[model samples]
Target: MSDFQPAGDGSGLRVDLLAIADLIEPSSRVLDIGCGDGELLHFLSGSKDVDGRGVELSQAGVNACVSRGLSVVQGDADADLANYPEQAFDYVVLSQTLQATRNPRQVLLELVRIGRRAIVTFPNFGNWRIRWRLMAGGRMPMMGNPGEYWYETPNIHPCTIRDFVVLCRDLGLSIEHQRVLDGAGKAQTVRIGGSWANLFGGQGLFMLRRP
Candidate 1:
């Protein structure tokens, strides 16, 4: 394994967000969709020197971001991405929000349409623990990150790494870079068109762009 990871400042950002920050270039324009409290936006602005902006679904989140002096507005991804013109930013990021979206494919289309590169992350439904829970106990695994029961959770369409790969292919988005992380938020060895990443990865992060 390469053990290559995104740079971090020990700012208490989630491992995935730190990973995302590593992918972004300096002085670029960034739009973070579903940016809860603008942690990633704040980190990117300070660490990468990017002009960062955010779109949040909750007023609480927007208020938090604003308090932190980050440019964030209350908006929903399913409804607002279309308002932006093409390639308005250098990078557009959506972390842990794709599955909860009403139309994941449509949102993805808009991501690449509005930014030169789109960075995305999601929980992996095909992880071994999740599979074993379903197979052995006939129950869905409870995710700790969001900490909600399956019935109470808002993720309408949970998907795996393999599923996302297929969707990206269907959408004709090129996968410039991808990372599969274990439960501890460490990167795993990449294996494209293989089941290892799907079977073992607890979370998946991808960088995509239109051809």
Candidate 2:
């Protein structure tokens, strides 16, 4: 097992979110798409002093964010991203929610159009463990809860780290920075966008900007 530990400042951010937070500058405008419970936003607001706004699809999540004094709205990324003005915020974050979107390419285009930079994180379907499991069991690999079946999972367009890198290139988005985490959420030293990273990385985090 990887000897990775989750990073937090008593605000309870996932390791991926902590990596995302590190890319953001202080006192900048941020729009977090699918900001569940505003945990990352709350962390950013407290630690980085950002003007954070969030859009969550679930009303329960929005309500929870509001309860924590966060500015969040209930909205869908597939349809609502088109309504935003061009370059409206300093950063736009879509963490682990890209696979669930109906039109990921269009959503990515809109993310760059609406914000100066975009931070995206997703589970790497090309991880060796996932591949090994599928080959050994002859079934879809379960990255999260093993009890949850494939049909019940929310991931529709789950892509590998290599797939994501190619998509960014095709979308004309420059990868400003990237981090690949091992199974235990530890940042790896492997070269970004390389085949080794794709095979070994359990999750991928990318900071993208339009060139």
Lowest lDDT sum, 10 consecutive residues, model 2, at 1-10
Poorest 10 consecutive residues by lDDT, candidate 1: 1-10
Model 2 regions lying over 4 Å from their true place: 1-5, 8-11
* Candidate 2 global TM-score: 0.93
State in Å the error of residue 62, model 1.
0.3
lDDT per residue for candidate 2 within 85-174, as digits (tens), equals: 999999999988898888889998999999999998888899998899999999998765546678877777889999999999998899
Q: What is the Å distance of residue 125 in model 2 from its true position?
A: 0.3
lDDT of 1: 0.86
Query: What do the candidate models score in CA lDDT, each in turn?
Result: 0.86, 0.87
Task: Give the Cα-based TM-score of candidate 1 against the true structure.
Answer: 0.92
Best by lDDT: 2
| Model 1 per-residue lDDT at 106 | 97
Q: Write the residue-wise lDDT of candidate 1 on 1-211 in tens digits.
A: 1122443545777777787888999999999999988888988888789999999999999999999999988999999999999999999999888988999999999999999999998888888888998899997777534457788877888898999999999989999999887665566775745788899887888999998
Q: Pick the candidate with the highest TM-score.
A: 2
